[model samples]
Target: MYLEKIDAPQDLRGLTTEQLRALADEIREALLRKLSAHGGHIGPNLGMVEATIALHRVFDSPKDKIIYDVSHQSYVHKMLTGRREAFLDPADYDEVSGYTNPQESEHDHFTIGHTSTSVSLACGLAKARDLRGGSENVIAVIGDGSLSGGEAYEGLSNAGEAGTNLIVVVNDNEMSIAENHGGLYANLRELRESDGKAPCNFFRALGLDYLYVKEGNDIEALTAAFRQVKDTPRPVVVHIRTLKGKGYAPAERQKERFHWGMPFDLATGEPKAAGGGEDYCDLTGRFLLERMRTQPELVAITSGTPAVMGFTPERRREAGRQLVDVGIAEEHAVALASGIAKAGGRPVYGVYSTFIQRCYDQLSQDLCINGNPAVIAVFMGTAAGMNDATHLGFFDIPLLANIPNLVYLAPTCAEEYFAMLDWAIRQREHPVAVRVPGAAVVHRPGPFDTEYGELNRYRVERRGREVAILALGSFHALGEETADRLKTEAGIDATLVNPRYITGLDEELLEELLRDHRAVVTLEDGSLDGGFGEKIARRYGPTPMRVLNYGLRKEFADRYDLGELLRANRLTGEQIAEDVLRIVR
Candidate 1:
């Protein structure tokens, strides 16, 4: 193979057009094979093959720093930079992360996962290079999808006036997670039609010189475009139009489903693993589908990721005029929801907990301060099993619970989740956010009270005496197991309390526990630092109540095992039971 003969970009320097094309084919095959065996961002990687090859050939990589926006499309870049074996060999698949990591190789300039960051990051790198009196091309490759975020616009605004050796390559794949949103995509289409000669160019409007490539996949065209902008005095944008799922037939047909996939069949592009039955994603989607049909004033919103709300493209189409995809703009989604609520519209903005951090100010100021009745469903908010450091779900509680006027609720089961959603929509006083469970999707025929009108209240699930286990949200099951363990092993049936509300303390119920309970065990699925468990611990600190807080320590646990993390944190029922036994013995 041509790939075996090449170790780095320097080796690619001598390659003919034919050889580069063959290398691109090899890279695509490798991407498909690796993704089939171990799931990854296949669509982005497949589309980026030719463009990556062109960039590597045009610039000195380690010398000329190229930062990938979000870095989901950096798989091809990784393969070329002495990491081809990681793709080809089944044994080495786990060796590298799907995203660009500087720890992996010198060619990888930054550890990127989230969107709309590369332009700003590259601007900083360019500024440093200039300050050192060094001359190296600093390139920021941002996707059209990432441009939806306000951060990308801010970066573009800053880079336009940069006046240095920087190239911002806008990879116009015509897709984010879903189809591109907002007026910018219309402008991008205009640019594509004009062949970089558009009158009102977004890039040019920012004062940066602009160049466009009609065939972003054509090796020759991309090579020429990169060469034209190489070592340029001021910042310039090389906007290249490329196919998202370029070579792969299945991926090309269904881009969003293939965006990030589980291990799938290479032959049919079908998921190898069977999906579970009617999880929270499905439940939420069904509920909203009905809600939107009934309530004309109700709007469902997603910031690029429809999967978070279980709004598949089908669901989006079904919701029709009621669904609003604000693209990758989380801040705007929050503010938009706030505005919608303020105008007597019921807006439910479903977002991943990791992404919700982007809109803290909006959540606090726009939604909470005004006290608009907008429902924000925060998914993947647990401490463990998340793949990337940049995308941790545990910290949202600390960031969110502290915010006033935002009543953050945690649902123990699927029924409770829906009930909270129902109550949140009907309420017109506070900004309510529900912390949805991560992996363990438990469902009970809950018929939970649609009566969340009363605030800061907790429900006692399995009441007992001597020891009370206050499990917050998803940890309710763990609390039940702990109570059962205490009964079976220690002859002590501990009280299992489900603290459904996270933002406020159930002071009345908490005070009631002090009578019979000898010790209180607070279990939460987030970090102990500034989390629900610590809040409980602090509440009982001035009292004689012996509070044991079980949760993750304040630290970034990158790609952790669920079982090991639980055991390490003494969060497992057995571990908590053992701790309780020792304390009470």
Candidate 2:
């Protein structure tokens, strides 16, 4: 009843402290019920219920701006911002995104999905307000995990000297996507234990005013704290210690598992439909363990996202001395990998396709410029993996492939991926990146070529006449399907080629195709603009050969059906075959 009556923050302003507690309970119950059926960031949402309620109760939304780092924990904020039905009602569950979006509501100022960006974004909002001579409260709600990133430090350092009204609420959940890493966490621990009275404080060192609240989960305490700095001039860091998965016992016990879990049984905490079979994560973890044993100089690095490489807590323990979790600092991870490789140690930085974007500068400058023999394994680099606009892995091509001195390899299958990984580690010539296909792991029917040391070389799976399909990475299987469909439907034996190297075009192979092939079709699982296919199309722009590039359009697609997305982009085998037939005309 209390929750139903609440449509906005104004509704909460009238409620007593006891009624607010009841609302928090109702919100948690709704989260548990809905998340069990349609999985989400359970741990984060559950943990932030009290704090979000307190925030809404204290600040005026659309006037008082609150910026969340990553916005993974913004579900509770959504509930108080006229979007409660999206979480409360199962029918409207699909209406809201997991992250904060300005499109969703005026309450959300930024469409933030990545971590360690809140302080900087908040500073900008505050600066803009200052320039316009407006007097609105600007709050940055960042986590303890976000503090590890280089960007957070930059923002905090800048905010310290902003000399304007800025409030940074450091939500110390003591967890990243994984357990906390780096020396900064030690300082945070000291600060937390000392109740913000730590003589040597990270925030104080950055020249920002500091306050501490030991009871972050207590709504009364949070409200009082927020009110204390409501209209404070100059930036102040309010460090609050809070439990990650507060109310739920299952999530509380296994904080990392509950951090962002699958649809699970709330009672038993077991996934409803468990995924089986070989995945890149588990495969990479095993490979790293074996590789570390063989090569003592081998080092596996992750940027607070060990799950990307299948390095669970158990796997990390097995890795022991070989593993390096550089916290949520992707830039640091890239630079660290470069340093390790330069010093005769083989460093492999495994990160999710989405998170790797944070280190584009470091990737181009620190790693590629030095031409260090470092292996950067990019996971979830496919249209089918991440459907979010901010987290889409489809644009990795434009980000990584365009950079010089980097060999970006696209693996067609598990065997080829392993082979490429091995080669990248052993070779001391250039910095290499492996794009792990999001498609099903295929062993194929034959042995993978051991002579993969040849860079910019493509493997011709099945050679034919007229139309040639140059499928890149995850699209290799689709290319094979299209090739077969062409033979059956159009009575033409089309050529099927797997372009393993993404960074450069196989000029020799393309020239060879022109001899027999009248039209070449390039298939990739990313954007058509500034992508692998566009590069190929440009390569044939001056030639007599016609090149048709098939890929997703340059736009942010949100929560789309995988099959519909393929059809809409003309990426399906039947559609691709039909298009290729027309091009062959």
TM-score per candidate, chains pooled:
0.98, 0.98
**Candidate 2 residue lDDT tens string, 72-147:** 9999889888898998788899999999998899999988888889999999999999999999999999984888
Runs of candidate 2 exceeding 4 Å displacement: none
lDDT of the candidates, in the order given: 0.88, 0.89
Looking at candidate 2, the ten consecutive residues that score lowest on lDDT are 438-447
Q: How many clashes in each structure?
A: 1, 0
* Clashing residue pairs found in predicted model 2: none
Model 1, 551-581: lDDT tens per residue?
Answer: 8787766667778777877888888999998
Error of 1 at 380 (Å): 1.5
Model 2: number of backbone collisions: 0
Candidate RMSDs in Å, in order, are: 1.2, 1.2
Candidate 2 global TM-score? 0.98
